[model samples]
Target: MPDRIFLIHGYVEDPTIFDKLVPLLPPADYVPVNLADEFLRWQPINSVDARQVAQYLTNQYKITAEDTVIGHSMGGWIGIHIKQLTGAAVVQISTWTDQEKIKFPTHNLSVLRFFLKTGLTQSRFLTSFFLKQYPFDESTELYAHLLDNANKMSRLYIWQQLQTLFAKVSPLTVQPDLRIHARADNIVAPPDETFVEVPGDHFSLVFHAELVAEPIRTIIGNRPITDIW
Candidate 1:
């Protein structure tokens, strides 16, 4: 059978995050799981749980041992939990197993969380100013998309994710088959031997799909597949 590749997106992001990587990968049944509908719809933060999302995806997709799950950021965390249930191979990009490994801009999440509670975080001025001051994105066009996304973003959901994300001692229970991180990633603490450090920030998969896609393609290509292309 053809290799199954499942693409899981992160918080508040749709399946379109993997658009650039899709065509670069080997032909297969590419399933981009949608886990952000609720977040995008402005649901309560308390309602969103990574484990719950993982469980839903596991049941919804009936992911098997032969399947490969590639996830970005928070999606990687969800994928790890799914792997624990489905025995599927997981690839984590820009995700940290250890809570201490996540390096937030300010160690005091309370300050950030407090700001997230207000409408200020979603304000056009604040969002645009942030993009200009702390530029993590690579594309000029993406800058505009991000500003647009901020308007639709739910600060409550992000606060919830941050609270739960750091509360865990070790979120990565299941070991992934491959780990890739960005060298200039300001969000996560420096990666060790477990990850192949690419040149980009937290969203390397978006701006630098070529850099990230090669290894993913190679892994899929080298794997034994019964399907004849």
Candidate 2:
């Protein structure tokens, strides 16, 4: 049987973010988990989210070992924990190492924090406004969908996630098997090894799914499939 490939999306993002990229990947059983989906009900901390994902894999898919897990940003953080639980090989994209934190401007972050604390983040208009401040293809439908997903997430859930992001990550609990980063990425610090550098900013990397998927297919040594584009 082909290896299972699990895709974990980052904060304020849903599984659909990987829609374009998934089809380009080599043939395999693909599972994309939306962290935001259970945010309101679970209000999960990082560790909790990881455990839940591990449990989901075990109960639903009977996944045990040697699975390929890919995560983006905060999702990458959770992926490391899943790796520990399942002995899975992990690929983290634009993910921060335990030593690093996202370098958002303090002023802007503070403003965002205030909104989260006050529940203003629940408003689609405000959430969209905050998201628009980031570098993305604002004209694209992907951006619109992302904004919609962000609005669906609860402010409390976002606050908890922000806390997890800023919290100190334990040292090398589980190292990623491969790291992918963009030269122009503003969200996370660049990785040191086993990395593939691609063009575009952080969000743009998702938009240019082929660039991201091709390197992953190579790393996994999966048979080449025809390009979707």
Candidate 3:
């Protein structure tokens, strides 16, 4: 049995966001897990979520070290934890380390806090307006989707979990994870990623298939599967 490729999306994002990249690779097995549920319920802050996700898939589908996992933003954080549990090869995209928070701007952090406290659903315009001000260069399509389906409180809970996790990460534990970020990204900052440099902002960074697939292909030690379309 071939190892599987588990793709995790960021906060307020759905699995379809990975549609493009999923087809570009070989057919091992692909699972799209929704991190947020109806009412936008975010999972409790625990590294165990990652472990559980890995184990759940492994039981349902055979997974091993040869298998690859890719995650974006908060999803990347989950992927890291999953790696700890599974020792599977990982792909970290537009992600941050526990230590990387030190580099984020204070004002942005303030915006994050405000966004979380107010819950974005009630103030969609205001939330989108604030994110536009940031340095993100990705397509707003996904954000627009999130705005419609997301529960602000759920988003806040996940954000808080991420912040807490980042604060406590030890420096020695920061391993050589393959991180790919957009050069113009403002969400997590391109510099925070270890293997940086790709096109588009945080949202588009994942939405645009071509921009992300090449680097991901390299990291997974697989040759690029040329697009048929």
Candidate 4:
């Protein structure tokens, strides 16, 4: 009965985004939830999406209070909702606590929203061009594959997610068990509210999986699975 480790990915992303980091963690039942799927396509808010994720986990894996959830970016917000639902231990990575901080000025999210509403988000070139500005390692095979996946995301789905991001999020009532943030992340402001600082930008932190996973492993500790039962 090892603690179930659930990985929740961010906007326009799927579970595969965690491919690099998942393998680096201690052995346990690992579950990766994909929020950018048809089932979650119509979700109006993160809380609704998180409830569906919680239901999926409960039905499929019997997820309980003992489970541990790790979330990245938008996923981190969902992790907070999951904590409300299941009382699971939460770990947030490169996530913003303040709604204002999540809105990066350079990204021009409002313009992107307009494009999405006007059905301009279908342009492959536009999507590629927009994503190119992000500080991901283009040389890595993982990022290349992730880019391909991102290109395929539906415009409406992306718009729905963006709406959730822009909506007023409730303040975190429970402190996350652990918080990991990148020192040079441009998308989200650096954590002034206590967090573990790792080298690299937002994407690079995930790119360098070992650097991110080591600290998580240390927090997870060496307790045997059966002991939790």
Candidate 5:
């Protein structure tokens, strides 16, 4: 049997975001989870929640160590926390690094405010309207997928997660980290303090599978995973 991997989605996203990448991945089983549901279940986000989620998903699939974790954006942060919690090798894409707030103050504040307000609303139209911020060009298949997911994601759950996120003392911190970022990214900039350069911005970085797959495969092959915490 192939090893197992847990692919966690970023804020305001669902598991389908990894559809393209998941298939291209090596033979390992991939379990994707909705971030909103996770946040809903775990009131205060921390390493413990991440560990529980990882263990639950792995158990559901009957997977063991030798699996890796792949996450993007907020998911990337979750990946690190999972690593700390589970002692898994992690491949973080377009990850928000510790230097982010200091490097891009305005962008960070804007995103925070948007998350704060968006997370509190439960409207489908409002949620759809908000996800339009992702850099999906009109003609791509990815655009259609985003549109479909806009309707599927739970607005109330997203809002609640954001509310909890707002109450967080510090969203990003340094510890057992592996991260990737686009050098030209404006959403999370300066690309330093535990981030590697990828091809595009946040959305593109997540969808770009080839760039991500190798790193993930390498990590999985290198070490055994564990439910550390």
Candidate 6:
């Protein structure tokens, strides 16, 4: 068997987001880590942050230098810390570096925490009415499951993650070996330079896995994928 390749999904997304991309990957034991399931279970000192979460994962999974971590969006941000712990190579997709500034809709984290902690973010009735009222495009479609996942997705999970992500704490200084991003992503717009430009947007991993997989294949090299779970 070749080295393990852990696939980390982004916020509010399950391992299913990788369904399309997994088949095209190079030979390795492709393992998808449910950031929600694992990260939510970890109790942290101070507040939850990427490094702490990564350490939890390192201890639980016995991550080592031979492994590779492939993370999408926010998952990619967390993957850097995994690299810090295990010396594992990292592949970041649709993610940003520390220098990149993001403009969140709500600057008030307290109010944002209120909704996520109260399960208001998973409200189907409110979501349905809002979709009807605003009619956001495909990106909104991407988050449609939020309406159905109220019971499955915990308020604590979302709230705690937001706290970790939004905390002024700087993400670890580790840089990924490869940074692949879609040029047309609406949700997390790709920077003009640096990234190996690919076709489509944030959802391209679903619609254009072939294109996304091209770069990944080269990085994965000659590893023979014996099995995946």
What are the TM-scores, per candidate, against the unseen true structure? Answer: 0.79, 0.74, 0.68, 0.77, 0.63, 0.82
Q: How much is the lDDT of residue 163 in candidate 4?
A: 54
Candidate 3's residue-wise lDDT over 1-229, tens digit each? Answer: 5446778787556787787776765565666766554213434444433345445545444555555678877677767765665566677777765535323444244565675667643476856775566543356656666655554445555554445334343333434347777766666666543575776777654566776777766665552322211
Ten contiguous residues minimizing lDDT sum, candidate 4: 41-50
Ranking by lDDT: 6, 1, 4, 2, 3, 5
**Each prediction's number of clashing residue pairs:** 0, 0, 3, 0, 1, 2
- Model 2, span 1-229: residue lDDT tens: 4567788887777776677777887767778876555455454454433445445544555555657778888778777767776777787877866535476554244676897777676786776775667665633465566668666766666765665465443455667777778767766767765578877766544667788887887767742212211
| Residue pairs of candidate 5 with colliding backbone atoms | 119-159
lDDT, model 1: 0.70
Window of ten residues with lowest summed lDDT in model 1:
38-47
Best by lDDT: 6
lDDT of 5 by residue, 101-163 (tens): 323233343465564466533445654664565553532455446546655655555444343
Query: Measured by C-alpha RMSD in angstroms, how accurate is candidate 4?
Result: 4.0
Total clashes for model 4: 0
- State the C-alpha lDDT per candidate: 0.70, 0.66, 0.59, 0.68, 0.55, 0.72
Give residue 217's lDDT in candidate 3 (0 to 100): 62
The digit string of per-residue lDDT tens for model 1 on 1-229 reads 5567888876456688889877877778888876555344444435444566666677777777788899987778778877887888888888855656776565456686677777765777887776676555465466567557656866655665565464443345578777888877766765565677788787788878888888887777766644514
Candidate achieving the largest TM-score: 6
**Tens-digit per-residue lDDT, 1-229, candidate 4:** 6678888887767776688887788777777877665345434444333445445545555667788888888777777667766778778888865666674543456786777777666566765665677664533455456557655777656665665566544455776778888877766776678988887766544567788888788767743344332
lDDT of 4: 0.68
lDDT (Cα, 0-100) at 124 in candidate 2? 66
Off by over 4 Å in 4: 38-62, 106-113, 122-125, 128-132, 135-148, 222-229
lDDT of 5: 0.55
Q: Candidate 2 clashing pairs?
A: none
TM-score, prediction 3: 0.68
